[model samples]
Target chain A: MHRLALSAVLVLAALSAAADPLPSWKDGPAKQAITGFVTDVTKAGGKDFVPPAQRIAVFDNDGTLWIEQPMYTQLAFVLDRLKVLAPAHPEWTEQQPFKAALEGDLATLGAAGSEGLLQLVIATHSGMTSAEFETIALDWIGAARHPRFQQPYTQLIYQPMLELLEYLRGNGFKTFIVSGGGADFMRPWSETVYGIPPEQVIGSQIAQRFEVRDGVPVIVREPEVAFIDDQAGKPVGIQRHIGRRPILAFGNSDGDIQMLQWTTGAPGPSLGLILHHTDAEREYAYDRESHFGRLDKALALAPENGWVLVSMKDAWSHLFPPTQGSQPDE
Target chain B: MHRLALSAVLVLAALSAAADPLPSWKDGPAKQAITGFVTDVTKAGGKDFVPPAQRIAVFDNDGTLWIEQPMYTQLAFVLDRLKVLAPAHPEWTEQQPFKAALEGDLATLGAAGSEGLLQLVIATHSGMTSAEFETIALDWIGAARHPRFQQPYTQLIYQPMLELLEYLRGNGFKTFIVSGGGADFMRPWSETVYGIPPEQVIGSQIAQRFEVRDGVPVIVREPEVAFIDDQAGKPVGIQRHIGRRPILAFGNSDGDIQMLQWTTGAPGPSLGLILHHTDAEREYAYDRESHFGRLDKALALAPENGWVLVSMKDAWSHLFPPTQGSQPDE
Candidate 1:
């Protein structure tokens, strides 16, 4: 090739290589906010520059990273677990909570309250080693499909959020999941789905004890609540697990408001974002009065706190990753 | 200069830069074990090779990385805290545990048992925001000096261990501190002294709650024990915090046997090491009968478990990092 032609080719390659880090995100304030924060923090000798070691970013799993509509995927997993264990526990067919869960009676289960929910959770989530629980969760996540979408739950992860995770990591930020979901439940598949290892995931947990059974050391789960990583508990979980205040935090509900507050409230340049469900056609759009992920308080407080609310309709070009056999049969 | 001379200079520079990764480590079986394990796991296409993402290493902080003799540095901090708060709590001067702690009566404190120790820990370790606690711990760790060594506790870190931490990181391994000390206490100075960040430090914790106090979101520590990261709790803590089983584990006491067992018992390549406090001249020596950092059962099980016993006397050429004030005053 001629010298001029080769120079032009090199220039073109460089420009394309520097193309949008978040192509799934629309060109809007939400994308700009993320890019701008990353740029300012990474530029050496700049006023807002943060060291690579201190660049910690936390994300919420259910609503923000994946679909939380038609009830949480974990709740679905628990309901399935209830059915699987029903044969072993003969009394479950007659019990109030277990009967409701086993029969797919959403109304009764919803009205069962936190106490009933806790009982169901303990029944389904405890009495096994962490390794065993992880195996069970892995198999379920692989086989189970979303009721409404007719696709695996892992397939419903937001494409723009995945791109954002990759972009932030490329910019020297360590990304973590600070979720209200069961840590063990999310851990088994998070690395495969989101490129986030289990060690970087922080979430609610049950009591666990380390014991040697048949000369093998194992950590067994107990029927006691260790923590609840929702609402105000989000910040508490972040402190307990990460040990450092996060520089950036992303969430979608009032459960995440304190986490945003804790991150952006720090004395440096920080970013806090909320993923608003506004694309009813592509995904569920209920927010303020929603039964699952309520967002009224956080939405109202976002402006004053300098937390950006990312509109799904305007911000994202795609809803999820393309999956084979995801289309309904004709 | 001649091309041959320049080539020779370049070769010399390359060889010097690639010298020993652990210079402070003596030529012994302990050093050989570390190098051999790292080589086998990191070599691509090798039978025992591990991927970079799965290369996890965990180290116990107290006895393995730094001085824990005479008394734990945290215990010393708690005693100082007792003295500082004694004026406020006149009644504590008469209380059994508090009286024993405030008066520096080690014999009486020893007689107080686990219940008494718990009382002391709760009194000093809770009732503040995590931010406030971090500040207090930072100040205490900075100002406090080891009584026997007459140097800051940070300066008393094992030189060979620090080299090992750096070497592991250089080989694409993520290193973490799994300590029995308070997570909040170790987090303040861990990054500065050990090059391991706060997010990578896991330890015992007290109950914490997030609340909006005076129009600010704060995570406050409550006066209750949440989880103890010691003995059997070591494996449980590793499971809860870092969900993946580590490929390498290091410790000095029985508290870490479960962690080592959990790591080495995994399917693939793994390594476990214990730092024996054998250098009585450079550092205090105690094992089976010591009140602090007792190492009895773990030592006996090391051979069967394939865990290497790193003799501090033979494995390390130096004890602690050199500090500006560490030299004796002439």
Candidate 2:
């Protein structure tokens, strides 16, 4: 009896020694809920559990993986691209979205809304082969700094979420980023930032044409929208690309509601988590009526679906790139 | 001395137990070549070897996994679709390729060439949603039987390759199908046929538009050519879908030449294999010049690229589905 008790104590110690990804996350109902589900599904003889074969977890990129505060990181990349390319294309002084971007008027640009966003994306995205776009994205992201943070846009990735990704993967989950951002745009940088390879990143895509341009058959960008991976489109992207409904889906806003709903609806050990922007001091906080990353429907869904609501105010110790003196003060 | 000999034998048994994917592949210089490389990489001490995370193995679907002799099973499915949908769209009688298909003169139908093929494909493939295409594929594949061979289209898959898929996966390689078939067509059934899920299958695709059709934003198919997962297009597909160069590539024809070359050139422990047709009685044997799956340039690249040439005749005791009986003779 003593020997059995000793073995049980040792096993508990071993479990305790396992690393938790989000160390700064407060041990509240949200944190408990996250760990509890992970433990139950991973533990042997647990009811709502899945084996390693089905250990695939998908995440939304924009708000979930990184800070999409003032603007989307990719769009910011494109706007910076327009500024760089604006010198060469002297005719763009009169173009619609490009013109607005060049002028740098926030209110006028905001009024243009999705149309302006789409136009900017298409203008910056098309007329090049996929290879060229990859090069362009790399060049812009490497050199350009976020307007508010004044750090490299890549540096603005969320700290707690990064740990969460590593955390899930450490516990036998194959984590993926399913975003509404352009697929190629995310593919080049995702591996470096999130450790999710290009294959594991599913995103919005425009139509590409295959033609022998200059003796090399290349996949060239087209202005047409191929698939929009936002809102209701999230489920379609997940269905089309990942195929399997993910065990865990995380996002911060109304844009991610469908993905959370789809994931929670899947009959298995699952989690639908929404990050509530309740902290304005350490990090930006806006929801419901907020223009970007609004957390309304998801906040409502939490109680009914048994979804975990991560309060950025309460849960995290710090926010917005925790690299001590690296990121500029907002 | 007796104990030493027993230990040595046990070590040899353990080594053989580890290398099982290509066990039936003939123990020639080719086989030794494969086993040696696999052993060097998988064993703890080998330099420039990939761990489990980097074990990405991609395969060509049509002739590599299943018989594409009579016609591309997908083409046959399309032809069947042409027949089924003909009565509904009599205007197709006025169409170029559909007119050719309706007449049943394959020589003339094929004579119209790529233009004719594209016209037929577009007319049949487009306008409907992706979900509709999947249902159409499922219905046709479940009921349609291949002529001459007289078996269900799914039953025409090679048993050896199926075993190989399972084996490689068991040893930590993520297998993907990079084929020129329509993505929707193959994705619907690939999971059932090859134990490969839809996400792992990359293929020729048409452009789609995201729009609110009847109050619901549906991804409707367009007649534009997206990326063709064939010939030189194969490498591009690999680059676009799979960000990393594949460690291993398998295909049966010259269409897979660039893919094989790309895989072989990957700077690590890599394998490139071509499935050569040599079995005359059980299956057709043509390589240098065949209508569909010709393997001339790729055959030439085997030695230069260090790719293994797998002769279907000698590699396996069985071809086709297991449920159809393994007997080679009537």
Candidate 3:
């Protein structure tokens, strides 16, 4: 009887160990805040209980789910695409942004500003069918490596955020990506990488036209920008696509401030999270003064707005999954 | 032992009777085609078998799911709104379309054409928060009745389509409403009527702005047409919203022709269906030359495209659910 009791205890221990939903997250305030909020909202008949269908959670993609510095991975893709397409247009060699992109000069590219970057994006991203664009994006995403990390851009996805996504989904929360990047660029691999489906991804989009190409229907991307899903545009995009206000919102930069405010500001029991890139040794860490993913206003407003600031230096034990190649030499 | 055998036979018989997915659909080519296609795509190891995640079916809302005869239900809502708001604006009585709308003159209103209709839509639909619009829409849908049927517009939904939606859902298919009508107009009642949630309904939308009104974030509908999910716009809308191409498409008008062609023309086994309103006695009759849902081009091209045309008179055992009020006392 004593042996049987011991065996039972061991089995219970094994089951208890397996029950940790966010195994990648360290046992800290950030993890507690997440699990506690989920518990409070999910318990049946409770004051703060939200119905399973209404448990909407939105996450900013770049910097929140993955790295965004020294520049956005999409910006890197645009630069590379500009280089590949430069030979066809001799005018590109003389163009300000295209010349900057072709020469691999980050300083010149920065000087060219958003308008120059927009020009590069439009020239390289449009004039093709959606299916063709999907193929090009998939091929590029598969082949491209992060310059600093020396790993596939997809591999740079934060392990903690992935676990958080799975944790939320397991609790009946429908997870969505409300990103500032192009929706088409993200949809190709979001499902495989983050378990979020294509329809759940709301992002910036260029105009597209549906036409019959050789008697077959095709949606061709156009040069005009239909929507820019950054800052205030985040909430607008979310409203247009999801048609419902999210209860939980996550972000890492000032661009995501409006989205967080829109989500948690609504009259309800809600949670807002901001990931602070504070670990300089393990990852790029520049806030308030950074060129890309500047976290000034959001950092200032976090405390007053009741948003939880997650310190990457302390909260995370693992930056990325094991399969993402070894860290680069400093 | 003999009694046990009898019980087993009775159980099997009961199971077989309950297994019929489309009880409302009469045993005809339309019903057979639906069942056969579902079976082909659901059976494991079959060449055409589709995974549950990939099993998407898009349905056109206006004419395919409900009665759009005489006029569209949304148009009726807009006209009603115009009248309610007319008391505040005496100038509306002097306006061409508003005057015609107030006097219940469908002829003059129709003569005012798309531009006049657009003006009415923008005036009535915009200048409200999405939440406010939802409440107004819900209240209107619940109270307003069809003139001919004298039943709530929600009750006018075709019984066969309801069964088909449930049947597809049972077979692991995700059903979505891809309508030309306003998404906000449909979202308030879609879940209760069609079992499709707000997020699953993709439709025409005006621009929306996220603003903090009285220290609360609200998405106010703006007075500009952001997108029109009809004709060529259907495929573009589908690509923008769904991201994945649907395997099954259903519609009842020329507006859905491009959507159907896009679905069936993809390199895979697909099904495109058109619901023909041929039963003048039971319900609507005019189709090919009708003002509301013109089915001219689709009818001519159905045979060549292998699109199944469902004859309402022959294929549906019941026009609508029994609770919709018997035959409008005709």
Candidate 4:
């Protein structure tokens, strides 16, 4: 009888061990915050809780899930392609945008602004079949290095957020990315990067055409764009693609304001968090005036909307690659 | 001993019944075709096969799965709304497109022609919150009837296709709709109509803005339109949304030619089936020259593409509302 009792205790312990919820998140307020939400939703006696089936947690791609600085990762690919195609198109030599792009001077490129940016993006993104674009994005992301960090562009993603995505998914949350990047560009590598499938990634879109070239069927990009997933476009992307307003939304820029607004405005339980770029030494810190990832409107709206603003400076133990280790306090 | 042997035979029969692949499909060519495909994929010796995970099936929503004749069900909806709102909007009587719409005159209403149709669709579709639009669609679908069919618009759907959708889903097929309709308009009702969730419904779209109106957030429609998912757009829709070429493609018109071509052109194994409208007595049969839902190019391409051109006159014993008690002969 005693032996049987021991066996029963062992079985109970084994089952408990097998069901450990989040093993990666360190024990703290951050972890508690997650567990608190999950426990309330999933626990038998918790009020203001959600059921398991409705456990939909959404993430922002660019800065929230991974890195989007030094311009969106796709734009980097476009810049590289601009270099490759510069010689073929001599018109680029005299053209204002292309000339600035070819000079490798980002300041001048910034001076040329959205018109230049649009011209560059359209030129690089168009003319390729969807399949071909996937190959190009994959190849560039695999080989391209950040100009400063010298690491592969993909390796610069936030480690804690990555852990958060997996932990949430492990808890039956359907993780999705509602980003302001091009949907096609993100869909190609989203699964590999964040473990979120292509279907769950929502973003901007360019119009494409279906044509048969030499008996081969291909979907080629048109010069026309369908939508730009920025600012107001973010909410539209979430509406058109995801249908469900996210139970949780994470963003680092003003562009993500509408997304947060939409997600939080839903009647039932929801979470809206902003990733504030506050770590000066570890990462760049500029708000309101920063051109690339402007966070002014989101900052102003955060308090009014009661959004949790994560001081990237304080919230994370590490920045990226995990192997590189955190930047020194200096 | 003889009684025991008979019981064993009965038990074997029961086991086979329990494990039967699909019981919904009738015992005919359609059934045979589906069974053969599954068998080839799962059988030990078949080379052209899919491992259950990669089995993605896409359907065109408008005509293939549901009725899209006389006018798209959504158009019928906007027209009904136009009539309802005509009284409120006094300006509608004097406006070019609005005046035409109020009079029930297609030619005059769309004096803008294609652009007029687009403007009407956009005007009616936007200006409301996502929830407002959803509720509107749900309410409209619940009560509205097709003008000529004298039945609820949703009731005009092809029952066999409905069964096929459920049947495929039961067998692990992830179904998607690559259509030419507005994505948001179809999505609000697709789940209720076809058991297809919004994310899986890809279609044409217009740009929308995320805004805070009177302290409440809403997605407002922009005047700018996006991709128009028709003809060549079908294949593009499949690529942009599904990311995988559907193994099985279905359509009734030449607008779907590029889709069939793209789906069939994918190497390895695929099936492209076209529904030929030939039963005028039961349902409308005019095709090839019809202003909308034309089937000429696809019909011509079927033979060389190894597609199955199904005759509505032959394949279906019943065309719609499976329980309506209307048999083909009757």
Candidate 5:
């Protein structure tokens, strides 16, 4: 091609890149809805324009942002931690939840209910300095691989959702992770992976106390649950941390129903998006009947609530970002 | 004067205005220490230079930033609320702590100790939706006047500290309020008064439940103590909310000593400052023996800890920001 023609083509490509922020998102209702809402809320002097300060967008972490497939990454962390600390706590070998955890008894662990889960979480998560906990979490995240994807758990994060976060942030929306997972677990890596700083992430908390150990101040995690940021807890967590009703909220399961309701139920123009995991070929498709991230009630209420149900299969042109030595999901 | 001379003079004036970020802060050791620390940390390629993301500064709200004398503003709100709520609860008139609060009997209330204070806080601060509580707090903050200052509580904020807050932000520092005041109470007006957003304000909290009442979601304030962000609680709150230790901390009481220790004890260049209320003429003075914001242990440890003790009288050229109806303190 001639120099002028080549330059014109490059200009056109740059223009297209500038026009489409969510390059991984296909041209569909889901993409249209997101862009439309963003434009409506961002256009200066527009009727639906929301000021930058009030343009808070909340996202649920597990199935919404990354793969929560086989099990939550935090649960995996807890189980792994249980094994690591098993020799230290000989009592855990006999304890109901600990025994179930050690034996990889999912049925028994599930049967133990939330109480049993809490026991396991506290046993593994607590009795260490916050710094120590952070190092452990970081190490796990760096080394842990997704069972199905055979990639680092961080690498398994949805490419389209990452683009959505960037797109929203580009439009002056403050993106936050309001997750049910432990805040401590996510804080170590959220900044690097999601471009979300620790303060912007709100999650379930364990009690912590400040101590001066050997003339140095350290925050020691206590073996008690302080707050849970799931379902009804999501809105409460948002209120407690952000102190402002988010204009936009996205999540996957029944655990996010209340957050969706709270966001869409606001007086102003708001957007609630439910990520319907419909692409089983690329990612797990189980929703309504799934044990984890079950989407029964939220899926049922989506149409009536005016929430945009995003079909991953149709909406996302890509699932995970490209990885070295790994082929794209065919 | 010639046009060229006038232009030169104008340039010099503009440059002078640009050079002084903290005009309200007099030229003294306190001011020098603050500016020196900020310069050292913000200067690129310097050994003490901290990245913008790690440049976190925390400020204590009541005594550090504003007038906490003549009793805390929250305590006054509680006392006033007791009167308003007394008609509904006739038994409160006969109750020991309630009666003391209603009668303004400080001695009796003091005798009742922390338990009584908690009772008062729970009674006044809870039993309503978060929105309702916010409106109530905002209304009180709007109308309540500092008895000695004879100005609205928000206006009683230190002009020098406000300048410092702006200066820090201008130097790429994220300023946060870590106070013993209720988060809900401060969230309503913190942004307006201190330019610190609600999310950045970490404080004491009461239990709150998320409820969908009449198809509308609301966070209802529960009459139970959840978390206290005072003394040792300050560091815990920082870790829980911010997930990072601040490099700079400013406070005025023994209640802030732990926060100072936590901030300065970090393995990096850090600055901890204690504001001493030594301005008896411009503001209330009594420190070691004061009922509220008593600076005793922190005062003794400031020198040993390498914490800058900022003398309000000597360091601050001005106290409160200019008010429409009030004259400046002579």
Candidate 6:
């Protein structure tokens, strides 16, 4: 009976050890920093103890939570939408950006620049009812697959980040996604994927108007860009939507520098984390000179700002979540 | 002993009956409508049942939740600020709106129209960091008393409406204040006064820019109108902030017509209520012909739209909460 009790105690110890909040994160300085910050802030009667209502945590989407590799997921969706909508507007066949997009000519499309991209985005994203736009986005997101991963785009979300979001939420912190991505584009799937409700997701927005047609009230998406939630816009967007400065912020690019500064610079205990894409084997690794999600200024200033640099190659034991019907990565 | 047991049973029955969710609401059709709608939507497995996540309730602030007679609380605040700021700007004594404002000339200020009001608002509300502005607003709101009521403006809030907010929250509905007032102005006190957080309050906003001044990050308010949250702007603001149509909406003026239409027009169980100020003896009673909070079009369309008209005099047993040192009104 004594021997049996000893074995049961051993098994219980093993189970308890396996219950680490962030199992996908390797034992490193990055992980230790995050755990330490959370502990300090949450300890009752401690110097850093923040009330639950003030425990606001902000996260950047795209490269921070998911994959933003050769191209952004939203950009991919826009390109696909352009092709699908080209036949409806025959003039698209002759238009420069449209023709370049149809031919999959990256060079010409790049040459068309931001104005051209804006035209493409507006054409695909607006001039429809908000509900209709949401349906179209949902349908595309459901069916679309990553070019290299051969998995659904949503499946490419980083496992460690997902675990971190859940962990923060478990500790009474209100997690908000303050992204440069379009708010409407992200809201449809954010709740199901990130466990964040639409109201908590702050992002770029296009002008929308309320109208009644056939006695049915509908919000119609217009072509004008109302706000951009990027760079300096990030802090402005956070202030506008949240009205309170977040105590913790996470991001992966220079576009997030302002947000991180705004968060960590606040008085009291705070933390800023930058995800360093240094894993070339598991995920494409490019920064500074990269076309997408370039991490430059933030990286140089990370140490001075007391921002934690989470090296993907060293800190993350696993990249993507386990795929169904497939063996788990060991 | 049997008589004593009967008395105890009767006392328990009285206690249970007194535990009505909306105690300040009188026994009337309006009260019944609100309770009935909440019951139907929250019933599990019922035909009219809605998921808790989609149970959104929106309320208008001015007149609907508090007194807006004599003048809007915000307008009064602006006038008071102008008088205090007169010494800082000697040019204001010469400027048209400023001169009229400093001299307490309501007719000239009114004749100056929205342009003059905009100038007054910008001068008083902008050119300061968000934190500074918040402190200023809080100080004013804490000290400002209603001209007629002689009570703090926050104390003039409708007691029955507060009970309704609590009741809806108890039934798993998330309550949001969609007001025409400035978001920053309301955010400083909304949580303490109305039990609504800053993030859940949507309203008019001015342009703001994020700046790092002397190694400290700040958001500076600019003298530009970014978006207006009144009239047609109501539904637009609701969609921008909440990203979901509210199932229940309450308002007191024509400015809320679109919001009411958007909520009840949805293909589900919904309720729209208009608070009719008919208590001239207790509170100011003006609607259709009133200069402020004119409830003309919405009042006429309320019957056909299936909106319940709640009479302040008949449907509310109490208007304001009990004061600390005053006897409770019967």
True contacts kept of each: 0.92, 0.21, 0.74, 0.69, 0.79, 0.80
TM-score of 1: 0.93
lDDT of 6 by residue, B186-259 (tens): 99998888899899989899999999999999999999999889988999999898898899999999999999
Q: Tell how far residue A57 is off in model 5, in angstroms.
A: 0.7
- Which digits, one per residue and each the tens of the lDDT, describe model 4 over residues B1-330? 254554454345336534543332345675567657656655556797675545777787777887777777778888877786677789888887878877888777645778788878877877666677778878888898766567776787886677667766776777888888878777877877788877788888777677788878887666667667778888877776666677878888887888888888987777777777777777778678775577887777888888777676766644565334343444
Best by TM-score: 5
Q: Which one wins on DockQ? A: 5
Docking class of 2: acceptable
**Could you tell me the fnat of model 5?**
0.79
The ten-residue window of minimal lDDT in model 2 chain A covers A321-330
| DockQ value for model 1 | 0.70
Write one digit per residue (lDDT tens) for candidate 1, span A119-213.
99999899999989999999999999988888889998987888899999999999999999999999888888999999899998999988888
Model 6 chain A: worst 10 consecutive residues (lDDT sum):
A321-330
Better of 3 and 5 by lDDT: 5
Residue A199, candidate 1: Cα error in Å is 0.9
* lDDT by residue (tens digit), candidate 3, B235-278: 88889988989999999999999999989889888999999999
Each model's TM-score? Answer: 0.93, 0.77, 0.94, 0.84, 0.94, 0.94
**iRMS values for every prediction:** 1.1, 4.9, 0.9, 1.9, 0.7, 0.6
Candidate 5 lDDT for residue A167: 89
How well does model 1 score by local distance difference test? 0.88
Cα lDDT listed for each candidate: 0.88, 0.75, 0.88, 0.73, 0.90, 0.89
Q: Which pairs clash (backbone N, Cα, C closer than 3 Å) in model 1?
A: none
In the predicted model 2, the residue pairs found to clash are: none
Q: For model 6, what is the error of residue A302's alpha carbon versus the real structure, in angstroms, after optimal superposition?
A: 0.5
